[model samples]
Target: MMMVQPKLTVVGAGPGDPDLITLKAINVLKEADVVLYDALVNSELLRYVNPNAEQIFVGKRRGCYRYQQEQINELIVERGYSKGHVVRLKGGDPFIFGRGAEEMEYATAKGMDVAVVPGISSSLAVPAYQNIPLTKRGSSESFWVITGTTKQHKLSEDIRLAAKSNATVVILMGMGKLSQIVELFQKEEKNELPVAIIQNGTTKKEKIGIGTVDTIENIVEEQQLSNPAIIILGEVVNHRNEILQVQRNINSKLTKSA
Candidate 1:
């Protein structure tokens, strides 16, 4: 019998919400012979996996990594070919700061058949959940998504440009540098620009802290919002309150009808 070449499937688990996972991702999980998942991926989604599938936790959190990126790459390549059907599940869209490309590059270079299933990125979904549109007609014509930390563990230089531009700015993995980010906006004379930070967005523990560049850092600090959070800045942040008010009124009406 001819040997069947093993294959690797990289699936994005979406944000924190298990329901946010795509049907395709679930289908792929059900077929997986082995699954390696990240820390940010919701464990709830794993229930869809084949009961006999091997599940490995290779999560990386702030200040801690169970397995470095290089190790992760090697494991994926090794197990993918050995395990027949391998699923590397990542949180959010794999390409969007999820390091999905790096893993795919390694797997493909090793002659393994690889595929990607995109997930809903928190960059857009988190803001929407908080009622902060990344772009609104006549408000922001463009939007920029930036990483809060660089390979050097320092704030990225692009943030300076983002601070100066008229585009709505969404910063991921930036809670630790909240003060530095706020300082950047202040330097650009955008001190009063609206800003909102959401922690564990789309999850039950979701918390949103809102203020302006001059005060957001303090707001986040007081709220104890930490990493695994996203910072949204621009006029769009102002719309959250309006949307909340509308929601409240609708809820009240429903209650009265009931």
Candidate 2:
């Protein structure tokens, strides 16, 4: 009998909302024999996994990683070859700073059939949920998404250029570097530029802290915002206030009618 090679599927679980998960991701989870999920992923998503499937927690949290990257890669390859079907469920889009590419590379190197299912990236969804559009007809023509931390745990040089450009800037996993990021803009005389930091966006625990480059770092500190947050910097941040005002007016009219 010819041997059958096991398959590996990396599915993006979307931003924290369970309903945001795509049907394709759910389908793959239901067919999985083993599921390795991240910490940021909503626990509700696990319900989609087959009842007989083995679930593993491999998420990385502040100052603690359940499984190191090297170990995770090896485990995926091992399970993919031995287990009938393996699903690596990640938070947000697997390619959007989710480290899904590394896993895919490792799996293919081991001769395993790998597949990817893209999810809604918090970079775009989080800002939209807060009523902040990444681009506007006259305000911004482009947007740049940047990682807050580099291999050395320092701010990326791209942020400097981003601050100097007219493009909207979105920073992921950058709450810790908030002070430095704000200072970068301050150096470029963008002190009054609007900035908003949203923590746990798209979930029930969501909180948004809005300020300007001059005051945003302090506002985020006072609000106790932390990781798993998205930082948006540009004129687009002001749109949220306009949206809220419009919503308040509508609510007032409805209440009076009632």
Candidate 3:
């Protein structure tokens, strides 16, 4: 009889980009006996898995949950024992509202050896990709990443405080609560604060709407943005245009010389 060595490795696939997955994560996927992936994970990364490995979609998207959290926990244990190594591939940093720590705790409590590989979080990458710095030297010395909704599906209380701070604020999965967000910021008398809503960020399908708190709601309606998007609020939002303008000026100088 063969001795079974069961293990579970939680790997972050990064934010929506196939090329963003870490080399260490790819190696882990290659050795996976079973892989459970999420909705935000780019499918192209699956190609790194061994041909004989079992691949499963355990993604939970808005309004669609193919497998609940409890079921996924059980699947990891069951597959780990049967398949040797079970890899849980999640989108973005698993610890960033991805419920990755819970999965690790469950697997560890079940007596399985657990490991984690961190990925770049969308909260930071999405805004940076658009030239919107989450933290700048003077304009924004800090930033806060807040979830759009709580476990009760209510707008997070953290938003109210974030709106009142000088730090740049990034709200994840908060598109549905745009009106509520506006109300909170307006209450802070930050009606003219710069805000940027980005959807499908860092991907070819990305769309952006930029406006002040007083006008962002209307911009969202006009752009038709929805879930899987992030909202950034702060003066740092203007840095994007400033950077672009600088680039244009350099281009003009080169054009004249040419």
Candidate 4:
């Protein structure tokens, strides 16, 4: 049998949209001998891989887990040795919240050559697709990207501080804490602050709920929005509507003139 060197490449599959992936990611996928992908990753991306490559799903959802973290780490090393090239395909930028660093360190310590390819994170792309800017000069001078839950699986305390600031707040994996999150902002007298929840963002299944700190929880319930979603808060949320209104006004004027 021909011998191929052991290697591991961590590639970000981008958000939900298959097209959002980087060209470099596609190139890497074409060379993969084995692919271990996540639940959040769009399966459409798999078509780019080598025809004979072995594909494995290591995805873990809210209450469903295909493999635990420790098991996944071991799988990477095992496959790298037996298959030659193992691709750890993750959703969004692997380093952002995906634990790409930990995987790299583990595999490297096990003697596997490693490489990383960054993907477009949903935090920025999701809201931008809705025409919501995280920062808009005088309106929003800055933005904060925070996890919805901590390593302990509890609501993050940082949300309290972010609530009191003027900066835009983007929370990932936060749908379950929707009620508590809004309550914090409401306590800060931001009851009317614009809020938006985007589920399955950047994909055909995308669903969005737009309201304010006081009303968004109900909107979420009525809309039945769930995890794998992005929550955006700040005046920035209003920008999406404002852009839509501008387009509406332009179309109306053109209709009248014609």
TM-score of each: 0.94, 0.96, 0.97, 0.97
Clashing pairs in 4: none
Worst 10 residues of 3 by lDDT: 12-21
RMSD of 2: 1.5
lDDT of 2 at 102: 93
Please give, for residues 1-258, the per-residue lDDT of candidate 2 as tens digits.
546567789999999989999999999999998999999999999999999999999988778998999999999988877776889999999999999999999988988999999999999999999889999988899999999999799998999999999999999978888889988999999999999999999999999899999998779779998878999999999888999999999999999999
Candidate 1 similarity to native, TM-score: 0.94
lDDT scores in order: 0.91, 0.92, 0.93, 0.93
Residue 222's lDDT in candidate 1:
89
Q: Per-residue lDDT of 1-258 in model 4, one digit per residue for the tens?
A: 898788999999999899999999999999999999999999899999999999999998778889989999999999999989999999999998999999999999999999999999999999999999999987899999999999998999999999989999999989888888988998999999999999999999999999998899889999999887999999988888889999999999999999
Candidate 1 residue-wise lDDT, 155-179, digit = tens:
9898999999999999998877878
Clashes of 1: 0
Query: Order the candidates by lDDT, highest first — what do you get?
Result: 4, 3, 2, 1
Deviating ranges (above 4 Å) for candidate 2: 1-4, 254-258
- 2 against 3, candidate with superior lDDT: 3
Q: In model 3, what lDDT does residue 154 have?
A: 97
